[model samples]
Target: MKPAPFEYAAPKTIAEALDILGQNDLDEVKLMAGGQSLMPLLNMRLARPSLVLDLNHVEGLDGIREESSGLRVGAMTTKRVLEDSDLVRSQYPLLWESTVAIGHAPIRNRGTVGGSMVQADPASEYPAAALAFDMEFVVMSSAGERVIQAEDFFVTYLTTSIEPGEILTEIRIPRLPPGTGWGFQELARRHGDFAIVGALATVRVESGLCCDPRIVLFGAADRAIRVPAGEACLEGAPPSEASLTVMGDAVFDAVEDPLSDVHASAEYRRDLARVLSKRAMSEAMSRAS
Candidate 1:
């Protein structure tokens, strides 16, 4: 079915878009950037907003920039640009590796980083990567702007902390210091399908011991699950087969409340988590070494 009849506004500037959004009842207004996710909802009549505020024509929301802290990507930047970016590939290999697997080339051409994060699909790759890297989001409203850490931005499956009147303007990724190693792995039914289970591991090694290691799991929880128990097992320990074995077991046991769906059973997802955790951590450690 086609979407319900709605007014469409394509604003050329951020201020204009904000003004349009602010003037309407936020619940009745929906923001459309890439429309990669929203269009399907609209086509199904799942989202029947009164006004669709399109941001494609808006200026200042389509570039990648490097900052003293890290890299800043405008909300409207496409996934394909991210995948092809040399800076991203070199400085943040995890980001590029994860993004390159998001979908087929055409899908990536139209999907935006902000759109995917705001969609908040539990199986999404970007949100999992964001959590793994401690990324930040900058949100704007007619009133002003505020920054939100990735941990707090994703609230639940298909939900986020974005207030109705606010727009996610940019994503900020912190620079990984020297000695950082990262790995990303996902299990999907097909090349471009949503992951059945996905894992991201980042390890920083010093003096032959792992430090500040993080393991993030997705497709097995309401949101990306950070495996603190897994990290704890690896931290301050030599990155060895024994440590990885222990960490993988801890992560498998620590997985809690995974929902069962047609894609897989809870037990199966747990097993995947256990297996992928070890694989990712091992790859990451090898890179760091």
Candidate 2:
């Protein structure tokens, strides 16, 4: 199938892009980033838009910038660029790991971080990373720009707080605190396949006790679910097998209503979520020591 007829717009500046979007909104317009996801949907006739504002030509939104706060990535940055950046690998190892594992070489080459994120796939690893790292989304519309927390950005399945005529411009990742260690784990059918269950655990151990540990789980619900119960179980507990078990159990118990896809039943996914949470937490704790 081919996409329905649509007009295209290439804006040179951020303001220009937003202006295009604002104008097209009057006629049901859509924004096109890398076209990795949108084009497929267009080809399959799943989405028919009257206008597509191509953001590729938009300026100042395609590189990584390091700052005192953390790393700020342009929305147009490709997955391949992220995976290859030494700065990203050393500073934000969790982000690098997630990028490398998402899709394969070709998909990574064309897929943009902003696209994957705004696409808001429930099983996408980046959303979980954003939540774990406490990332921020910088969005703009004709109304002007404002920042939103990662957790609050996702409103529902395949839906976000990004409103009409708004576009995501950058993601702000804060610098990791001293003694912080991060780990990412996923259970997938294949090396690059979407995870049936995914876990991201960051443990900061201070003075031989768990402190500031966060275990955020994805691929288990309509959106990413942060297992606060698991993190709480580790709080003030000694880094030992018993604490680990309690943490894992808490993560399993946290998911009261998990989704059931044809690939995996809710029961099996819940079990994987438990095991992966435990394993990921153990590894994260080890590095924190």
Taking all chains together, each candidate's TM-score versus the true structure is 0.98, 0.97
The true-versus-predicted C-alpha distance at residue 221 of model 2, in Å, is: 0.5
lDDT of 2 by residue, 1-289 (tens): 8899999888999999877776655547878888888998999988899988889999998999999889999999999999999999988888898888798899899899998889888788988888988989999888889999998987767788888778899988887787787888998898888888899988888889999989888899888878888899999898789998988788788887778988899998888888988888888888885
C-alpha-based local distance difference test score of model 2 = 0.86
175-261 in candidate 1: lDDT tens per residue? Answer: 877888888889999999999999999998899999999999989899887999999999999999999999999999999668689
User: How does residue 177 of candidate 1 score in lDDT?
Assistant: 72
Candidate 1 has which clashing residue pairs, if any? none
RMSD of each: 1.0, 1.2
Superposed Cα deviation of residue 37, candidate 1 (Å): 0.9
Name model 2 segments beyond 4 Å from true. none
User: In angstroms, what RMSD does candidate 2 have relative to the true structure?
Assistant: 1.2
lDDT of 2 at 8: 85
